[model samples]
Target: MILSIGCSEPLTTREKGAVYGTLGGAGLGAIIGSATGNAGAGAGIGAAVGLLGGALIGDQMQQRQNQDAAVQRQLSTQQAEIERQQRELEQLRRQQAR
Candidate 1:
């Protein structure tokens, strides 16, 4: 009998941080706006501030993605090199056997 299993991709730390930060920002914005008499202006300013903060956070997530990609490329190159060396070694062994 053969069994197959599926695995879900894990969320990176940066992604997790961004998700929590967005939720926190929205909650704080609402609370701040409600506490102050100028709810409208407060909301507007909050939104702007929240948007800027979110963008900076999103930028950080993108930076992590870039770093991960660089590491993956390096690993792939190393794997390819190992495979090539193995094939060459096999060919040399076969030649000696004949």
Candidate 2:
């Protein structure tokens, strides 16, 4: 049985961006296409363009997020090492005082 915990974002940034772009493009396209008596065509073209643009933007964002995560992981490891060294130093100080 698979249970989903609400620990993750429902959609990836790229997917979210794509969805938004598609909706916005379709709306705008429909408006313009209606004026030109070719709403369907306009919407199709708009959706395609929007999808491409959104995907690119989302991919960049994802890359940035990945980089940030890597940095965070590195920082965490460093912090743990520092903590361990501090504990070891405390132990040494106790021995020296005895």
| Per-candidate total of colliding backbone pairs | 0, 0
Worst 10 residues of 2 by lDDT: 1-10
| Residue 73 of model 2, lDDT score | 100
Per-residue alpha-carbon lDDT of model 1 for 36-83, expressed as tens digits? 866666666666666567667877877988999999999999999999
The residue-level lDDT of candidate 1 at 12 comes to 49
Off by over 4 Å in 2: 1-9
The superposed Cα distance between candidate 1 and the true structure at residue 3, in angstroms, equals 42
TM-score of every candidate relative to the true structure: 0.68, 0.84
Clashing residue pairs in candidate 2 are: none
Candidate 1 clash total?
0
Please give the TM-score that candidate 1 achieves against the real structure.
Answer: 0.68
Candidate 1 runs further than 4 Å off: 1-27
